[model samples]
Target chain A: MSSTLTVADVERIAALAQLELTAEEKQLFTKQLADILDYAEQLQAVDTSGVPATAHVLGEPVERDDAERPSLAIDEAVGNAPDPASAPGLFRVPRVIG
Target chain B: MLQSTASAIREDVASGRVSAVEVCRAFLDRTTAVNAALNAFNLVTSERALAQAAEIDRRRAAGQTLGVLAGVPVAIKDNLCVRGMTTTASSRILEHFVPPYDATVVARLAAADAVVIGKTNCDEFAMGSSNENSAFGPVRNPWAQDRTPGGSSGGSAAAVAARCAPLALGSDTGGSIRQPAGFCGVVGLKPTYGRVSRYGLLAFASSLDQIGPFTHTVRDAALALSAIAGADPSDATASREAVPDFAASLTGDIKGLRIGVPRAFVADGVDAGVRAAFDAAIGTLRGSGAQLVDIELPHARYAIPVYYLVATAEASSNLARYDGVRYGYRSARDKDQNLKQMYSRTRDEGFGAEVKRRIMLGTYVLSAGYYDAYYLKAQQVRTLVRQDYQQAFEKVDVIAMPTSPIPPFRLGERTGDPLQMYLADVFTVSANLAGLPAISVPCGFSEGHLPVGLQLTGRMFDEATLLRAADAYERETDWHAQAPAI
Candidate 1:
């Protein structure tokens, strides 16, 4: 099977990623992403019957004691915020709603 | 003084034969001298290095016992945070973002008393195979100014090769560390996944990323690994396995060690020089009393496809945190713009071409209708890749292959064709997929004099065996001793 990535699909994916691509990028990605996915279609040939998908290489879930420890201070947590000083302890962003 | 090994520097500083301050100065001077020609360092932390060095001297004067790495100078890949240092992953997004805390590995290096020389440049967000994707600029290979130092850990590898620092930290997600190390003719080790803590490493494909080191020698790689390999409460993924003294494991003996060589996998698409060097490396292993067995890793050839899918999927998710409101670059806004538009504009403006490409590819594969066809299929194939290694390890202690399919290519060589660049990692990505420890040691050079590496991959959490085999190979070859004439 070949990838048929179209401009509309590229726009949808870009929107999902919260990326504003230039018109040139959208056109370029349509062609490039298709080539990549086409190459990735090689996986379809492998009969992975009864195979389990691995999210991580390590098999077991790591568990630690439910314990309290010193965490990042409020100031340090927001230290790298784009607008750190304006809002005492919180990050300031553009208005979310009308 | 600049070419002194990490172990030698540690000993001299501890004995007061050479002050830590003096060693730091020598490396700082070397970095200043050669960095312009190589573009290896993104920022040199001179003040911090001197301060740390002086503190080491002060402690020694007071008759305090020095730490394992006492006065060794090391470079950090920009992806790993150094407290208060501008830790951009070589991307515009984080161009001015200074991390508030040091990464767990960085803190461990300090705990071992190693001096941090500076941060080195890398592929943006450690996303590309070549360092060309760095927003700052591409790092030139010391061997040939026009060729790429294999990356995304190019600067760290170049710095070690140029003798600016005895060691440098690099993270391997696909072939980041090993590929660069091979091209630079230095030793690069990627310890078992979860072997080294990744607490403050700017997340890039979390499941695959592993922190390791580039050093002038295999023993130094082993030494560096010992100082930073362990579990951390902050990183639940870090293994709880006992951190063995990796240096002690380098007995310079691989007698009767069984090495698996997948001749069929490496047969085609290999450069002639690399193939000859690999053959000689196998001969050397045999001459050293190590047993060689032919093995199969049928799924390894598919590593590039599987890696691109899984790695990009994870990258799309991890990088989603880089919205305009948080730490990092945010695009200037018009008054009426909303939050979503701000994030979009910020990422588009801040990210480089390759990073955007990966993010886009990642987002597509994980999209609703395509998830099972692409991402899930890739993961299942990933299990096949791991099982191949597991089956092979049952018969052999380690698997051997060329670190990269070909030697370092010219700058701008493969950048245009992303698929061709992905294929260069043909032999190296299996280690990451299988969570096995792997190392790249300089075996020989190409006809063009660019270096070629021989990679040895071992079972999970068995860095000792891998380090032992690499150290044993180093004992039999002088390729590691050769330095590029800058």
Candidate 2:
């Protein structure tokens, strides 16, 4: 029941992931990813009919008192920013809109 | 002194048998001597390590009692941030990005007076089973330089096996800690999920990722775990449960302990040598008062596929933050490109082949058409896997299994095949998926002289029993005593 992934599928997947793959990557991934996915099709054979999905094993959210605490200083938070230090103390990015 | 365990190192340092600085220097010298062959450490923080050691010595001179891990040399996996150190996750993306803070575990180790020697290598973003996926380089197995030390914690395990560091920190998302330890013939333990804080561990899979220790002995693992395992105000996921004295449980008496041996773990495709070693280890457990109980983990067979779906999905989202703007590697190709092109180019250039595969697969599974069919189904199967553990634990105190179905393979054997590499983790991922504490301790050696490890997984938050059982086996067997002639 498992067919190979097409070149078009790799392109669409790469685009969705915001990745720019070379032509070699496209061809290689189409086969490799398809093989992995086909192998993963083994899970479908098992009946998980009414099993509840486990988003987290603990399932219960940890409750903590919401209290004010010290946080990372602004400079520390943006210390590794690629942009130059700015007066607004924020990392500058490419202009979003004209 | 070269083969000293972490616990012994701490005691010797505190008792004035050796100065902390000298202890650190000895390991640092050993690291410099052998790291070229092992390639275990990505960056040896010699200056920082000496500084920390000097402080410990000063305190000891002032007659102040030391912490348990005081003066023990530790190598942290590159994934954990140490303030101002280039805490690259062995990926090109963060090759130069330094965090401004220490991880919760790092801070704890510092407070405990442990000396951190350096950062060890790992798979790019902790994505692969073999160390070959590392952007820096594969950590050659100390046992056989031609073979890969199992990974993505290969560097940590290799450093310990090579005696570059007596204790090292590794993060386990899907057996990154245990598999490599299994391959390297050392002790590694992944605490129950939320047992240890995850604040500074570069996220591979948030829910599944756990910081653990690689040590020469089970008692050393217990000591290291004690130093780092506790609740942190910064990490809400860390459990507030009072940590038991893990070392105290190593009484070498596990009389009447029930250890479940899951047939699924020893099923077909496991190497003959590994299976033989596993059966012999089970026999040793029987000799040491641990009762063998046959058990069924019906849905555990789906662990590999489920882990890939869940961990990659988490990776896809967690790694999306590394765009061109704020931090991490932004490609020079982004110079004149638009915002969209900048993001694509930076990621495309930053991530290695395996990391890109996971990201793309993660993005695909989480996309509109496949989310329900793949990701959701995997999560549902994850529930079944957890249930299987829950039911099995009802009848046994711990589950004993082979750590890896195969021994260490040649460095490039599985590089071209992702599925085969993923299967290397088949026996180890179920513990991660179920959020249980598991330890891999040297059990026996294969015919090739490569090491094999026995895995013992305990109930949630029951690390004491797991460590005690492992220590009992270590006491009864000389496997842990044998080190590879590096």
Q: In lDDT terms, which candidate is top?
A: 1
| Local accuracy of candidate 2 as per-residue lDDT tens digits, B294-389 | 999988889999999999999999999888677888767645677777788888999999999999888888988789888999999999999999
Off by over 4 Å in 2: A1-4, A85-88
Candidate 1 per-residue lDDT over residues B170-245, each given as its tens digit: 9999989999999999999999999999999999899999999999898889899999999888898998999988
All DockQ scores? 0.85, 0.69
C-alpha lDDT of candidate 1 relative to the true structure: 0.93
lDDT of 1 at B268: 97
In angstroms, how far off is B205's CA in candidate 2? 0.8
Interface RMSD of each: 1.0, 1.4
Candidate 1 lDDT tens digits, A1-98: 33667899999999999999999999998888889989998899999989999889886856789999887889888988986667578998888997
